[model samples]
Target chain A: MDQFTLNLLFVGASFALYIGIAVWARAGSTAEFYAAGRGVHPVTNGMATAADWMSAASFISMAGLIAFTGFDNSSFLMGWTGGYVLLALLLAPYLRKFGKFTVSEFIGDRFYSPTARLVAVICLLVASITYVIGQMQGVGIAFGRFLEVDAFWGLLIGACVVFAYAVFGGMKGVTYTQVAQYCVLITAYTIPAIFISLQLTGTPIPALGLFSEYTPGGEPSGVYLLTKLDQIVTDLGFASYTEAHRDNLNMVLFTLSLMIGTAGLPHVIMRFFTVPRVSDARWSAGWTLVFIALLYLTAPAVGAMARLNISEMMWPNGTEGAAVSVETIETDPRYNWMLTWQKTGLLDWEDKNGDGLIQYYNDGSEALAARAAENGWEGNELTNFNRDILVLANPEIANLPGWVIGLVAAGGLAAALSTAAGLLLAISSAVSHDLVKGAIAPGISEKGELLAARISMAAAIVVAVILGLNPPGFAAQTVALAFGLAAASIFPALMMGIFSKRVNNVGAVSGMMAGLLFTLIYIFLHKGWFFIPGTNSFADTVDGSLLGIQSTAIGAIGALLNFAVAFGVSSMTAETPQEIKDLVESVRTPRGAGAAAADH
Target chain B: MDQANQTPAVDKEGRTYWKANIRLIAWSLAIWALVSFGFGILLRPLLKGIEIGGTDLGFWFAQQGSILVFLALIFFYAWRMNKLDRFYGVDEE
Candidate 1:
C-alpha cells in the first residue's frame, strides 16, 4: 500500500481499538467512573499510569529535544523519570491509603480549611489546563502532517476525538484505552529504534545497541557512534553530542525541578488510587517505570543515530565535503519527506542569494558567519524547522518501511489523546468531587454526583478543545509553562504537607502564595505575565535570569521558600492537635494497607 | 476537615518510627539528588574523561542510565522499608 494509505489505516485501526476498549470497560457506577472501582491490578494500573504519564511530549518531543540540542538537554530525561521516584516513595502509597477522590481534597482535609482546598483546586486547574494545551497542539501538528490537513483543522479533528473519547469513557474508559495506547506507542517507538540499531550496530535491542560500536562501511567501529556524532555536530558549529554547555549548577537544579514537579502533578498522583492496597501501590509504581524506561532508554540511541544520519545526508561527501546540492532535493526520492513537509509552511527554505544550493548552518555563530560570507552566502537557507518535526521526520531519514512510518503517526496521536483523557478526568473529578460535593453541597447522592462528574467532564472537554484550537503557544513550549505552574503551586504544598506536619493551613497557604507570586512574576518578566510575548520588560536569556537561574529551575527555589516560610510561620502558631499528629503517624505506616483511612 | 478520618497510630510507643522514617527519606533523597543532579549535571566535569559505551558517564546518568538506577533505588527502599515497617510492627496487617 502507499505510505499515505497505510498512515490512514494505522490511525483508523488504533482509534477503533481505543473506542472498542472504552465500550468494553464502560463505567457502571460513580465509583467505577472515578477510580475504576479501585480494583485495578498493580501491573495493569502501572501500564495505564505509564500511558498517562508519557504524553505527546515524551513520544514526539523528548528524543527530538536531545537530537537537536545535544547533551545540554539531558535534564529532560533525568527530571522526568526521577519525579516518579518521588511519587512512588513519598506520595503514591500514602495517598492511595488516604483514598480521596482529588488531590485538593487531601490538602483541604489535612490543613482543616476549605480555603486551602480552594487554593489547591485553583492550582490543579491551572496546571492541568495549561498542560493540556501542549497535547492539543500536538494533536493538531500530528494530524496536519500525517493526514494532509490544515493545522487548525487538524487540531479541530483531534479535539473532537479527544472530547468524544474522554467524555464518553471517563477514567474507567480512559484506563483501558490508555493501556491500548501504551502498547501502540511503545511498539511504534521501539520498532523504529530496533531497525536503525540493527543497521548501525548489528544489535537487535536499541538499548544495548546504544553502547555498541558503529561501522560506517570501510570505517572501523572505533569511530563510535557518539564520538562520530560529536565530531560531525561540532564540525558543523553546533555543540558536541555528548558534552553539554548549560551551566552545571543550574542544570542539576533544573532537572531536580522537573523531578519534584512530576511528583506533585495532581493528575498523575491520582492514578495510584486506581489500585488496591499499599503494597500494590508500591509494585504498581515499579511496573509503570519499567514500561516508561523502554522508551527512555531507546530515545538517546534514536536521537544520536538520527543526528548522525541527517548530518551525513546533508554532507554526502563527508563532514568536510561540499553540501548536498539543491538539485538533489528535487531529484532525490530520499528527500521527499522534506519536500512534502515544506508545503505545510511550518518548514521552509529561502535560497537567499539564489545560488541554487541550500545551506543549513548556525548563521549566528561568528566563525561560521565570517566564513560563509567569504563563500558569497547571503544567509542559511533552511527556515522554520519546527522542533516537532524531528520525530516525524526520523523514519524519512532512515528510509524505513511504510507501515513503520504509519505506526509513528498513530503513536503520536495515541500519546496526545491518552494524556488528554487522563487530564480531563482530573478536571472533571476536581469540579464534582472537590468543588460541588465538598464545598457546595456537603451532601450528595452517589448517583447525583456521578451525573455531576459526567457533566463537568463534558464541560471540561469543550473548554480544552476550544483552547486547543487557538492555543497560547507551541505544543512543546506550552508544556513547559504547565510544568512551571505545577512547580510553583502544587509541588510546594504537597511536599510540605507530607514532610512537615507543622505546616498548618495558615502556613501552607502563605507558602503557596509566596511561591506562586515569585514564579509568576519571574515567568511574566520573560514569558509575559500571561505568556504573551513583548509585554515583558526582561529578557529570558541566561543574562536576564535572576541569580543566574533558568526559569525552569526557579520552581525548586520557590519550593524552598515555601518550606522555610511554612515551617517558620507554623512555629509561631499553635501546633497541630494531638489527634492530627496521630493522623500523620498512621499515614506513615504500611499496615492496614487494604482499607481506606477515614478522617475523623 | 481532613483530620476527622485519619487511622490513628498510637505514637507514644512508636515515636522512633518517625525518626527512622526521616532517616530513610534523608538518605533516599540524598542519593536521588546525587545521581540525578550530581552525576547527571554538576559533577559531570569530574566524569569528563570517563566514558561508557561511547558516551560520558555523566551523560549516561542524565539520560539513559541514571533512571534505571533510580528505579532500582526506589524498589530497594520499598523492600527494605517493608522490612523496617515489620520490625516496628507497622507492616500492613
Candidate 2:
C-alpha cells in the first residue's frame, strides 16, 4: 500500500476502536455521565488521565521546544509532572472524599456560596475552552497532514467523532476511549524514539541512549551524545545543549505556574472524582505520573537526537566543511523527507546569494558571522522550519518504515481527540451539573440533567470546531492564558478550600477574581489586550517584563496575591460557619466516601 | 450530612489522621522542591563536577533524575497514606 493508504488504515482502525468503546460504554444516567458511576479502577483512571492530560502540545510540540532550546526548556518537563505531587498530596484524595461529580460542586458546597461556584465555573470555562481550542486545532492539523485534506474537513470529522463518543458515553465513554488512546499515542511516540536511539547511540532505551556515547555505524565513538551535540551546535552558533542559560527566577516561577496549573485544570481534577475511593485517588495520581513519565523521559532524547540529525543533514560534509548543495537536497533519496515537508509550507529553504550550497546556521550569532564571512556564505538558508513538524516528520527523517509514519498519524489524532473529549466533559458538567442544577433550575430531574449534559457537550464540541478552524492569532498566548488562569485562580482557591476552613465565601470569590484579573491584565499588557495584534502596551521581552518575570511566569505571583487577598479579606469579614468547617473536616478524612453524589 | 454521621470519637480520630497526613505532605513537598527546584535549577552550579553519563549531575536531575524522584515520592506517599487510613479506621469498605 502507498503511504497515504497506510495512514488511512491506521487512523481508521483507531477511530473504529474509539467509537466502539463509546457505543459499548454509553452513559445511561447522570451518575455514569458525570463521574463514570464512580466505579473506574485507579489504574484505568490513571491511564485515561494520562491520555487526557497529554494533549497535542505534549505529544507534538514539547519535544521540539526542548530540542531547540536545550536545558533551559527543562521547565516544561519538570513543571508539567511536578504538579501531580501537589495533586496527590494536597488535592486529589480530599476532593475524592468529598464525592462530587464536578469540581465547582466542591467549591459551591465547601464555600457555601452559589456565587463562588459561578465564579469557579467561569474560571473553569475560560481555562477549558481555551485549552480545547488548541486541541481541536491540533486535531485538524493532524487530520490535514494524514488525510491529505484541508484543515476544515479534518476539524469537521474530528468534531463529529468527538460528538459521537462524548455526547453518548459521557465520562464513562471518554474514560475508556482515552485509555485506548493513551496506548496508541505512547506506542507511536516510543517506537520512533527507540528506533532513533538505536540508530544514534546503539541504546534501545531512548532515556539511557540520551546519556550514552554517540555510536555511528554500530560502533561507539568514545564521545557522549550530549557532548558531541554541544560541540556541533555551538559550532553552528547555538548555545550548549546541557548548560542553563535562562533567567533563574523566571524559570522557577514559570515551572511553578505549570505545576499549579496542572493540578488545577478542571478536566484533570475531575478524573480523580471517577475513582471508587479516596486512596484510589491518591494511587491514581501516581499512576497518571507513571504513564506520563514514559513520554516525558523519552522526549528530551528525541529533541537532542533530532537536533543532531538536522545539523548533520545540513552540513553533510561536516560543520567545518562546505554546506549541503541545493542540488543534492533536491534529488537525494536520503533528503526526501525535506521535500515532502516543504510541500506543507512549514519547512522551506532558499540558496541565498545564488550559491548552490544552502547554509544553515544562526545568522544572529556574532561568532558565526565571522565564520560565514570566511566561508563566503550569505545567510542561513533553512529559514522557515516550524518546530511542530519535528515530531510528525521524525519517523520519515530517520527513514523508518512507512507503517511507523502511519502509527504516528493515528497517535497524534488520539492525543488531540482524547484531550478534546475530556475538556468537553468538564465544560458540560459545569454547565449542566453545577450551573443548571445548582443555580438555575434546582427542580430539574436527573434525566433532564443528563440530556442537558449531552446537549452542552455537543455545544462545546461545536464551539471547539469553529475556534479550531479560525483560531485567534495568538495560539501560544491563549495557551499561556489558560495556564495562567488555572494557576492563579482555580488552583489557589481549591487548595485554600481544602487546606483551610477559615477562608469564607467572600474571601474565596474575591481572591479568585483578583488572581484572574491580575494575571489576565499582565498577560494582556505583554501579549496584547484580548490577544489583538498591535494592542500590546509592553513588549514580551525580558527587559519589558515586570521584575524580569514574563507574562507566562506571572501566574505564580498572581497565586501569591490570591493567598494574601483571601486571608486578608477573610480576617476582616465574617468567619466561616461551623457546619462549613465541619464539611472541610469531613473531606479531609477517607471514611464514608461511598459514591459520588450530587447535593442540591 | 457528614457532621451528623460523625461522633466525637470518629471526629477525634479523623483530626489526628488529618494531622499525620499534613506532616507527610510537608515532608514530601520539601523533597520535591529540593530535587527539582533546588538541584535542577538553583543549586546546579554546586554539582558541576559530579559528572555522570555525559553531563553533570544537575543536568541529569533537570531532565531525568528529578522526574524519577517525583515518581518515587508519589508512590511512597500513596502507600503510606493508605496505611494511615487503615490504621486510623478511616478506610472505606
Candidate 3:
C-alpha cells in the first residue's frame, strides 16, 4: 500500500477509537463533566493525565530541538519532566483534597473573595488558551503533511473533531479517550525509536543504546554512540554534540521556570481532581511520570540517533569528501522524505552558487564560510529545515516500513487532540463553573450551566484556531511561554493559598496581577506585542535580555516577585478570616477528601 | 459522625499530621533541588571528570537521572505519607 493510504488508515482508526470512547463515556452530570465524578482509579487517571500532559510539542518538536541544538537543549528535557515532582509533592494531593471543580474555585474559596477567583480564571484562560494554540497548529501541521490539505482547512477539521468529543464528553469523555491516546502515542513514539536504535547501535532500548558502542561495520568496534556523534558533527564544523553551549545561569533559570510552570498548569492539576483519594492523587502523579518517562527517557536517544543518521547520510564518504549530489536526493527512495516535506514549504534547499552538491554543515563558522567561498559554495544549501519535522520524519529518515510511518502520523494526531481537549476543558470549566455559576449567576440551573460550558468550549476552539493560524513561535516554544505565564501567575497563588494561612484576598489578587502582567509584558516586549512579529521593542538574543535571562527563563524571577509582593501586601493588610483559616486546615488533612462536593 | 463529634482531638491530631507532612515535603524538595538544579546544572562543572556515554555525570543527571529519581521520590513520598496519615489517625476510613 502507498504511504498516504496507510497514514489515512491509522489516523482514521485512532480517531474512530477516540470518538467511540467519547460516545460511550458521555458525562451525565456536573460532577461527571468537571471531575469525572471523582471516581477514576489512580492508575487510570495517571494514564489519562500522561496523554493530556504530553502534547504535540513533546511528541513532534522536543526531540527535533534536542537533535539540532545538542547538549544546550537538555534543559527542555529536565525542565519539562522535573516540574511533575513539584506537582506531586507540593500541589497535587493538597489540591485534590480541596475537592474543587476548578483551580480558580479553590483560589476564590480560600481567599474568601470572588475577585481572587476571577483573577485566577483570567490567568488560567490566558495560559491555557496560549497552550492550546500550539496544539491547534500542531494538528494543522500533521494533517497538512499526511492528508495533503491546506493548513487552515486542516485546522478547521481538527477543531470540529475536538468539539464533537469535548462538548459531549467533558472530563469524563476526555479522560478515557486520553487513556487510549497514551497507548497509541507511546507505541508510535517507541517503535521508531527502537528500530532506529537497533539500526545504529544493536540495542533495542533507546535509552541504553544512547550510551552503548556503535559497531555497525565491525571495524573500529567500540566507538561510543555519543562520542561518535560528537566527533562527526564537530568534524563538519558544528559544535560538539555532548558539550553545553548555553550560559549555566540561564540554563538553571530556564529549568526552574519549566518546573514551576508544569506544576502550575491548570489542565494537569485538573487531572488530579478526578482521582478517588488524596493518596491516589500522589500515586497518580508518580504513575503519570512513569508513563511520561517512557517517552522522555527515549527522547535523547532519538535525538542523538537521528542526528547521527542525518549526518552520516549527508556525508557518506566523510565531510572532507564530495557532498551528496542533488540528483540522488531527488530520485533516491532514501531521500523521498524531503520531497514530501518540501511540498509543505518547511524543508527546502537552494543551489546558491550553482553547485550540484548539497552541503549540510554549520555555515555560521567563519573558517567554514571561508572554505565554502573557496569551494564556490554560496551558503548552507538546506535553507528551511523546520525542527518540528524531525520526529514526524524520523521513521522515513531511518527508512522504516510504511506501517511504522502510519503509526507516527496517528500518534502525532493523538498528542495534539488529547492536549487540545484537556485545555478546552480547562477553559470551559473556568467560564461556566468559576465565572458564571460561581459569580455571575449563582442561581443558574444545572442544564443552563452545561449549555454555557458547551458554548464556551466551542468559542474557545474557534479562538484557538484563529490564533493557531499565526503562531508566534514553534509549538514547543509557544508551549514554554504558556508554562512561563502559568508559573508567574497561578502556581504562586495556589501554593500560598495552601501553604500560608496569613495571605489575604487583597494580597492574592495583587500577586496574581503582578506576576501575570510582569511575565506577559516581558514576553510581549521581546516576542512582539501580542506576538505579532516585528512589533517587539527588544530582540530575544543574549545582548537584548535583561540580566542575560531570556523571556522563557524570566518566569522563575516573575514567580519570586509574586511571592514577595503577596507576602509584603499581606503583612501590611488584615489577616485571613477564621472561617478561611479553618478551610485551609481542612484542605491540609487527607481524612475526609473522598466525597467531593457536587456543587459550590 | 463519630470522628466529627471528636473535633478537638482530631484537630490536635491534624496539627501533628500537618507538621509531619511539612517536614516530609521540605526533605523531599531539598533532594529534588539537589539532584535537578544542583547536580544537573550548577554543579555540572565539578562532576566533569565523571563521564558517562561520552558525557559528564552531571549531563546524564540533567537529561535522564533526575527524572528517574523524581519518580522514586514521588512514590516514596506517597507511601511514607499514607503510613503517616494512618499513624496520626487522619487516614480516610
Q: Where does model 3 exceed 4 Å of error?
A: A26-34, A150-153, A168-174, A217-220, A441-455, B1-6, B9-13
RMSD of 3: 2.3
Instruction: Identify the superior model by DockQ, candidate 1 or candidate 3.
Output: 3
CA lDDT, every prediction? 0.76, 0.84, 0.85
> Which tens-of-lDDT digit does each residue in A524-574 have in candidate 1?
676665556567767666778656776667777777777777788888888
> Comparing 2 and 3 by TM-score, which wins?
3
Per-residue error (Å), model 3, residue B51: 1.6
Identify the candidate with maximal TM-score: 3
Restricted to chain B, the TM-score per model reads 0.82, 0.88, 0.87
By the TM-score metric, which is better: model 1 or model 3? 3
Task: List candidate 1 stretches off by more than 4 Å.
Answer: A27-31, A171-174, A217-221, A440-474, A597-600, B1-13
Compose the digit string of candidate 2's lDDT tens values, residues B1-93: 344555353366777888898899999999999999999999999999999877999999999999999999999999999999889887875
Clashing pairs in 1: A109-B2, A591-B92, A598-B5, A599-B4, A599-B5, A599-B6, A600-B4, A600-B5
TM-score of chain A, model number 3: 0.95
The number of residue pairs in model 3 that clash at the backbone is 0
Q: What TM-score between 0 and 1 does chain B of candidate 2 receive?
A: 0.88
Q: What's the chain B TM-score of candidate 1?
A: 0.82
| Clashing residue pairs, backbone N/CA/C < 3 A, model 3 | none
Note the DockQ of each predicted structure: 0.56, 0.67, 0.57
